[model samples]
Target: MVDLTALLADLAAESAQLDALVVALPPDAWRRPTPAPGWTIAHQIAHLAWTDHVARLAATDPAAFYGSVIAAPDPARLVDDGAAEFLAPSARLLARWRSGRTALAEALAAVPPGEKLPWYGTRMSATSMATARIMETWAHGEDVAEALGVTRTPTARLRHVAHLGFRTLGHGFAAHGRAAPTAPVRVTLTAPDGSTWAFGPADAADQVAGPALDFCLLVTQRRHRADLALVATGPTADEWLDVAQAFAGPPGAGRKPGAGRRAGARA
Candidate 1:
């Protein structure tokens, strides 16, 4: 069984870190555009709050969760005023996010072990669900942090994000409408603690090796893969980096290497 307690703790810690950054931002900084085009820092926080609430519903009531998201008033404006209150006082919105995430943790705890919870695209176990939340928190946190020119120290917790990134390699390809190559690919990432974390079949001819930070950044769509130090061997693996995404949903038009660094929404 997955350790729900530990997973929740980790997710909360990441949330708190992002919260601290938001708390310290100047009022004007809140309006500054993040890497995600059309999404300001405030928008990022708002989206997080909205998603947390959605996560809670998914955990506690799968039917309603699907109904609401599928029938939302306007999917295009879900991140704007149509979803959560994006213009609420920053402090209040942040508190709501904190509270919602806590509620999500509680709901997840009530889930029967091994039973999957419904999410945006597929069902997720409590463990996978929590980790997905963590990944979203961290990835969006990067957009907020980068907008403020903040550089955070990478941590071992990133291993969860990295694991997700590696696990989703095929999803990334499939999401892009490409048939994922069946050939085996290996990943060797140097963790923040200097430990090596590797994935994929041993002696696999195809491989990706790089710093965990870059891997996480790539999968999160926070940075263009070409600008990072990550190396990919084999043609398929190499091309995969161009569109790598640890996230679900439609294949994102990833950041262009050396393109406008300050543009784009944190999709």
Candidate 2:
């Protein structure tokens, strides 16, 4: 069984890490653009806060959650709309994000075991929901770090994001309107501490291997695959790398080859 408590702890840590990055930013700094197309640092935090708000509703009030979804002006712009709705002064936005996330964590922890919570066109267990939050916090944290010219040290918390990326292989294919391959693809990654983190069948012929950080960046679409050092052994694995996405909804346009931190922290 998934350890919901441990996952929640990791979620908290990931959020705290990201919070540390932006907690003291000047008001003007909040307007800095991130790698995500039109998102500023403020937009990034607002997105997280808005997601936490709806996610809390999903846990505490299912009907209200669905109602909010139905009331969305445009489904295609849901993510951006939420971000814009939650935009505020730096202090208020920060406090809103912190409180919203805390409420979400509490709501999730109170959920009954085996119960699933409604999500964006899907449902997930409390553990899975927590994991998803960690992935987003870390991915967006990367954008925040890059914006501040800060290179964060990868932590074991990335294991959650990496695991999510590996588990979302089929989702990635389906999001692109392609059939997911039945063949298993073994992923062997070198963790931040130089330890091996392997997933999938041990004897699988198709394989992807690389630094855990790079894999997380690729799956999150924070960096172009061309800029990553991952090696795919089979055609399936190769194609999977090209279309991988850790987030739900549609496939992202993703960053260009040189759009990431290739040039410096400023990149």
Candidate 3:
């Protein structure tokens, strides 16, 4: 079982780091477009803030959140237009985002450990919910960081995201309208500190081996699979990498190879 408190602490730290980077950016930087098509830095921040608000609603008031946020007559257009709706002066948007993140953390922490929280796609335990939040935080932060030309230090916290990716392999497949392979696929990664981080059974035949950073990048849609140094063995595992995704909802059109890399960060 994952340590919920530690995960919350890491989530807070990740949020704080992103906050520092965004808050310090000059006014023009907020308006600059990110790697995500049509999304400016302001859009990224607004997306996070709005998602946090929705996450809080899911945890604390699922029925209400669903009625209002999910029940929108034009859900697709709402999402498509969402990043633009929360725009404010850079300072106000940042402040709103920071406050939303803080409240989200608190709201998630209040949920009972074994109870499930309703999400758009699936119900999640407190640990899973927090881990998903961290994954989104890190993944979205990358877009913001890349836009500002900021290089971030990858941390062991990525193990959480990598684990989520590996664990949710079935969800990724099903979300994309594909059959999920039943065979266990091992993932062996070299952590930042040079220690090995392995997932799945040690003796599993199907396997993926690479840097933890690369694995996280691939699953989060931050780095296209072709650009990642990940090696997937066995037919099922290889095919899995072809469409690996860490987040839920509809299978999104992911980044093209070399399309989203930030300057001065690893290729």
TM-score each candidate. 0.93, 0.96, 0.94
Give the per-residue lDDT of model 1 (tens digit) for 1-267. 558888888998999899888887677788888888777888888888887788788888889998987887776565564234645676777778778888988898888888888876788888898898899889888888888898998878898899899889888888888889888889999999899999998798889999999998889887787678899999878978976778767766668878535644354
Rank the models by TM-score, top first. 2, 3, 1
Candidate 3's C-alpha lDDT? 0.82
User: Which window of 10 residues has the lowest lDDT sum in candidate 2?
Assistant: 258-267
Better of 1 and 2 by lDDT: 2
Best TM-score goes to which candidate?
2
C-alpha displacement of 44 in model 1, angstroms? 0.6
- The number of clashing residue pairs in each candidate reads 5, 0, 0
lDDT score, residue 90, model 1?
69
Tell me model 1's lDDT, rounded to 2 decimals.
0.82
Cα lDDT of all candidates, in order? 0.82, 0.90, 0.82
Residue-wise C-alpha lDDT for candidate 3, range 188-228, written one tens digit per residue: 99998899999999988899999999899888777777888
Best by lDDT: 2
Candidate 3 local lDDT, residue 198: 93
Q: What's the C-alpha lDDT at position 166 in model 1?
A: 89
